[model samples]
Target: MNMPNYFELFDLPVQLPVDVSLLTANYQQLQRQYHPDNFATANDNDKMVMVQKSAMINDGYHTLKNPIKAAEHLLSLKGFDAATEQNIIHDADFLMEQFVLREKLEDIESQDDFVILDDFHSEVFARQHDVYKQLLEFINKQDWEAALNQIFKIRYLTRLIEQIEKLQEKQYAL
Candidate 1:
């Protein structure tokens, strides 16, 4: 499929911090217009076209919907090689920290043992906040390279939080 311009894809401003109301309206309109059932009059090829367009619209909406995702998309468009999920561990220290957190989470022996997990959560949240700040600041300054690195950091922290939440939920289930 030919890649539509990001702005054209979502009917958005093609700029950072897009007008969200306009984007939302346009997305819904596109979705309704291209919904496969609505293309019943068209031939198979035409229907496929509509389906692809609808998928592009959905993809574009998601990219511009959240600030972190928007920032990452913008950076990627700028040619920054923001690490994908597979390459999230660019920093050894960050990986080691995740390792320790995972270990602590598995060894939760008692209610009191959960205190250390709480402390770890605080530390992780703080680190995640720091990464978020850096990402936003980089975007504000149009520093796509720095923003790419920050995006990876954000993904790492986000995954860690998911793992932590899983562990916490398990503890409560006991």
Candidate 2:
């Protein structure tokens, strides 16, 4: 059996800035067609095939849905090995900023000021949005270096956001 790529499976162009609504609609249609329930009475082989198809469809949807994963997939298609090259973030300034951000996150427990936490969260959120926009631009240009830098920043910001949420949960539990 021939396997269509994620973009082909979704009937979309293999690029960034996808139409999410259209993706959702296409995914829903594909899911309905391949849902295991539809093959309940079929032969074991047919049921197994349906199960695999469903898994592929779900994986495709999620991979395309997330900007980071989508970017990595696109890079791979363009002959760039993102997974192997991921460790080299060439922006020293950005690395320093990340270090500072991590330090602030570590200090969160000692800082009793909720306002400070709120401000930090807002700052990180804004930075995350900015990085995402920058990432899109880099992806559009196929500028691997810039895109990788932004991806690193976005990942760090995401982790920081998760940490912030955990801290908030702890505060609320008090």
List where candidate 1 sits over 4 angstroms from the true fold.
14-20, 83-123
Best by TM-score: 2
Clashing pairs counted in every model: 0, 0
lDDT of 1 by residue, 100-165 (tens): 766665665344456776777788889888888877777888876667777777777788888777
lDDT of every model, 2 decimals: 0.73, 0.83
The 10-residue segment of model 1 with minimum total lDDT is 80-89
Candidate 2, residues 60-172, lDDT tens digits: the string is 89988987878777766666656776666677887898899889877876876677877888988888988889989998888977787777778778988989878877877
Model number with the top lDDT: 2
Tell me each candidate's RMSD, in Å, in order: 3.6, 2.3
Candidate 2's TM-score: 0.88
